[model samples]
Target chain A: MNDFVYKWRNPIFGSVSVVLFFLGWEALLTWAIPLNPFIMSKPSLIFEGLWLEMQSGQLWSDLLISGQPFIFGFGAAIVVGIFVGTMMGWRARVGYALDPLLTALYASPLVAIAPLVIIFFGVGVSGKAILIFVLCVFPFVFNTYAGVKSVDRLLVNVVRSLGGNERDIYLKVIVPSVLPFIIAGARYAIGRALVGILVGEFFAATAGIGYRIAWFSDMFELSRMFGYILVMMVVAVLFTEGIRWAERAAFPWRVGM
Target chain B: MNDTTSTAVSPVPASAAPVRDEGLGEITRRTFWEANERHALGIGFIVFVLLLWEVIPHILTLSRGMDLFFTTPTQVAMTLYNMFASGEIWPAFKFSAVAFSVGLGLSIVAALPLGVIIGRSHTMNAMLDPFITAFNATPRLVFLPIILVWFGIGMWSVVVVVFIGAVFPLLINTYAGVRNADRLLINVVRSFGASEWQINKLVILPNSMPFIIAGLRLAIGRAILGIVVAEFFGGSSEGIGVMMNDAAGKFQVDIVFAGLVIFMALSLVMVGGVKVLEARLSRWRPENVKSF
Candidate 1:
């Protein structure tokens, strides 16, 4: 429990745990245990396969392929979600009117019905973007709606009492307070959009990480499949970590937000 | 108000005992479903939307051939009725249900203890934070290919996907709930010679109940998503997802819509039912700033 020891203890322990996990993964595949490597390929093999894929230039193209759909879909979700959410929050009637529809969609497995989307948008970038849009938009809208609704009424009252106009109240008080929630919403939206791209690619697509993953999995190339998954996870982690860092940088005064 | 202020410490005070609105739970659930009870306008709005779904397609079909892409509500209802009559929907529904329940059960079992450990000790949190965060952020769909390879194309793989989908929200919420347990309460219990286990049992667990329930609500949504996705891509070829996919492939838009209705019903039942249950469980718990 010493303060000095505690500072380094966790990081060291984390590193040790990760190393132990990889070691186990490596050791599990045999030369010793007879559990098919084709099924559960070792970490070294996976990385090596990934390295080979990298050199073949497949990884870069897949990244670019998935990246465009991700950006457009996620960007649209942010723009439209915040607008609709804020509007719903600002007007009680709008919220009530939309509640039944939104709630149904929220509860249902809309993602599973990707084929229906294909019928509408066709199997193009537009279709993929629409898929991502549907998947990612809800979190942002809900968060922004909650953010707006939960804004301190007392603060608004104080602003109005001080002769603040509607524009001033919105810009200075509402927007500032709601910004953190928007960013938080965007964070979740990123993951949802990622799934949209992957799922979209999985069903119908030409070039993407998900397409490669499916292709490898089908061919029984477990190592390459694992490699792609590893890369996918790394990209996801970096995106999430980036968002979290941005949250801190943006809201320096707000702790544990 | 003036009289109450003057009688601040009255002997044998009539207001000594707290009163609860027992009907409040049912009333609030009704409010959520009906929005406001002023004139049953929310119910009207819902009905209107359903009617529109039926009417619009009919209008379009009357003018041109539009039913191929999207079907009317009557067709969907009839398809649903026929599917049930033929006993086709049951097997798939049962399969998906098993996956959902098993996955959710496993997630709760695994996450509760882990969440408590990481939450109770800052050291554990700091050590495991990176791994947990990274896993949570990564789409659970990514694990599908791995699970399929490891578990093979079966219910086990589907269950694994559900577990991955649901576990994080549960774990993170439980952790937050534990961390945010009142320090003053902990100190008070400690002063009274309460052990760590006692504190956790009597104080921490109850304090965290609402958070856990909220997490469960979120986890159900994720689990539903997981089950459907797992069925589609993880290779089991038999669940509601499979049935929907088959319908979609066959251009049975009505059947697909029927399946969508079923999914909606299941979702509503799970989430709405759980929200009511959470409300009931935490009825006696004191209110604080909701971390959710």
Candidate 2:
């Protein structure tokens, strides 16, 4: 119980501090800012907006609609990124040939050409998914490439000398070595993918968190917009923490340093 | 043995001075050509892309309107020249330039020292890791609304976004650099009765230079990306991002492409500039070259 207390102190303090920070924000809004209650929202007002949205069921419906394309696009990015990364990583000739091309594509301003994407795929699920895919794929591909490159070259030689099969080498050496990097890449990818989806919604969306934001902005409902932003932020934090926890659990070797 | 073979392919013409004493002119030419021959494939790929870009629109679409969507290099180039003539490009470029400079300068100043301080204390790194992770997890762009609230919708807002985007890489790299400094070297320096300042200046700074530069490379790329996103999202008055947004809203696909092309070129130049600086710094520490 004492040990638990010691461990929990930081988290508890962190939570309290966050609460205090928001309370301070509430206080500031109450005391400061010249605007009336309607134009600029207080924290209490935003929470009320959030409550109203929850009661009206708009939040859930928007979440479902937004989540569908996000999942599809993110899934596609992972599969394609892993496949392309593995291909480039394993074959020297392929790596030499494709590196520059991939680098250029990866470096391009995907958001700028988002309109062209919308034109090609229509301002629908496909367009947003494509945007998400383009934005999400680069870190996965690049990090996986780096991961594979950084694998123990000596281990590969040893496996070959020991007459290990291709499957054996991949299962034993390459996969394990690159796992951490892939996790890191995925962590990065999720954030980018989220941003892409949000931006896509902002530009050309019928529904989603982005749509809600735009809706609120158009209506001058600052409280509702702030609430939506906060909700999305909470979701993001949870997702990030979940992945980080899983990473730490899976890579226990990295712990107790 | 590997060093000699690799040095043979080193492209710095300045290295030719070392070869001059050995009268290896023809060999230098052969090596340079061999290296260039390898890179020729990359150049060829670029040419193929340019050709494809030019040819695909013509072959795939019959309508002139469709050409606007799938723009050719010529169309983009013409659009760029048109924008240049109209004097619309400079304001956007200047805005981005100023924003990037201020943001990157602030990031370097703030993050590097903070990283060093954090690196010096394992307890601090451990304690702050989660908080840092939480910050990193939230897309730096999300700070746009909050920054807009704090600083209003202008150049300062854009700079703040860019600074937020750039700082993580800088801080991470700096901390990593300092923490990974050779313990033996530190001990040796300490044994020599050097002051902490002397040790940090002579040992820590030099050792961390490469990592800081690596961070700077990432920072520049990220900074440009942030500037674009910030301008697009925040009420940025002028920038390539704003130009792209306006062009897209107006359905001027070619101008959008022009704005994006300029942004890409600037990003490439920034990365390349950082790389050259990194190379120059790496030259000073021959013994420190191989590991990192």
Candidate 3:
């Protein structure tokens, strides 16, 4: 019995806690307080609303709309950020020259520039994509730069002393060392990318999950709004977990690094 | 984020020395330039960009249209000056300041104790881990709609947003710090007949200082973003974000730029302050480990 308890501890406790929380929340709304559904929604009601929305295909369409810019922007960020970060990292002068500007950009709330982005790119997919790009790029840039900087001097020297040329050094030493940092940066970028898509859609987009969220809120469809929020939460969890799984698969030895 | 902090402050490495022989005066000049090279290059690059930003639009005849959407640094500066001179920015600034302080204060108060509890307790950690992970993973903005519904479109709603944005990072980091506290020191305290409370106060808290400070650094950025995005979404007509939003709608691009500049400055000052505190607090350690 003790062995079984220990083996199943995490799942058992996690589920019980989650179930009890939802039950308590439902009971509090239903009996203890009896608040209006329009003001505060219950979990069952949220699930029901979500089911209806899913059946109507609205949720799928919204996901598709939101996913486009997220993919484009995130993909572009990975390419450009890695290139720029590599250049900055490999060349000391390049890093010095660009350090101040990059730091300022990284430190600031990039979302505040959403309006300006919309103005230049227009209220379209391109604008939202650009916003996500700006939001997601810095983590990649900085992390990759740090990774490059952190490469072992001894390893590089070993490569050079063994008749290895620049390409050989890069392939054998630098790329392998920096791959983990790039993955770590991607993990960070996922959250920022979500924020970018939301803010972009909020600012000007005509379609997308963010637009649906705003529309539901404005119309006071509280249950549906909660439903969409749950979808967002699930999406966030899935994306994060997926990346973690990839990281583990790619670098099994560096599990906690 | 933690990685960037160390890299940002580390001194830049000087380039390889020129091998060719030269005059003594020329060599001295070259050495001086090399010593100050990073700062000079950084400042010079910024100035060049600003000049280009000021000139390119006019040269391309895009300035006329640009004024409607993009503004020059000079225009942005003038707008900032006029806003302050006319006392126009104070009310918005005051509102945001109050919300920021209150929300961040509440986050610290709530997270620190709860984090310590969860970190120290196996049962509590097991039960709460899933919930914490879920909330932390979800963008805090997703809560804004429900928050606005519950708190209405005002300071409280904005405060709640900021609190949510700032709290998770602090809580998670604090928990990590406590869990990763020096177990050897705790054992030493136990051997000395210290009670649980004494152990925590004497060893755990002090050891976790760096982690808590790193958490605060992360929280400040999230909190600032929360302030602007919350105000933007909430339609509160009395914060910097609201002011910027209003300016955008009216095509007052300069005002928007000015507001963004202020936000950037606030972020830099607050983050820089926290970095200084972190450095001071961790001075005793031989090497500061990056924690997030």
Q: Say which candidate scores most in lDDT.
A: 3
Q: Which should have the higher TM-score, number 2 or number 3?
A: 3
Query: What TM-scores do the predictions have?
Result: 0.86, 0.82, 0.92
- Tell the DockQ for candidate 2: 0.23
- Listed for each candidate, the true contacts retained, as a fraction, are 0.47, 0.23, 0.57
**What residue runs in model 2 are displaced by over 4 Å at the alpha carbon?**
A1-13, A27-45, A150-166, A253-257, B1-37, B81-88, B116-131, B178-207, B282-291
Residue pair clashes in candidate 3: none
Q: Give the alpha-carbon lDDT of every model.
A: 0.83, 0.79, 0.88
Looking at model 1, residue A256 earns an lDDT score of: 64
- Expressed as tens digits, the lDDT of each residue in B1-292 for candidate 2 is 1121221222345766667646665666566557675467666777888898889856775577665466678988999998889987898889889999999999999998889888887556756665566676666765566567667789999999889989989998999899989999999999999998888887888899999998898888788878888888755878878888877777787888888788778778778888888888788677646336
In candidate 3, the second chain superimposes onto the true chain B with a TM-score of 0.87
iRMSD in angstroms, per model:
8.1, 6.0, 4.9
Q: Candidate 1, TM-score vs. the true structure? A: 0.86
Sliding window of 10 residues with minimal summed lDDT for model 1 chain B = B1-10
Pick the TM-score winner: 3
Tens-digit lDDT track of model 3 for B82-177:
999999899999999999999999999999999999999988998998899888888888888789888888999999999999999999989989
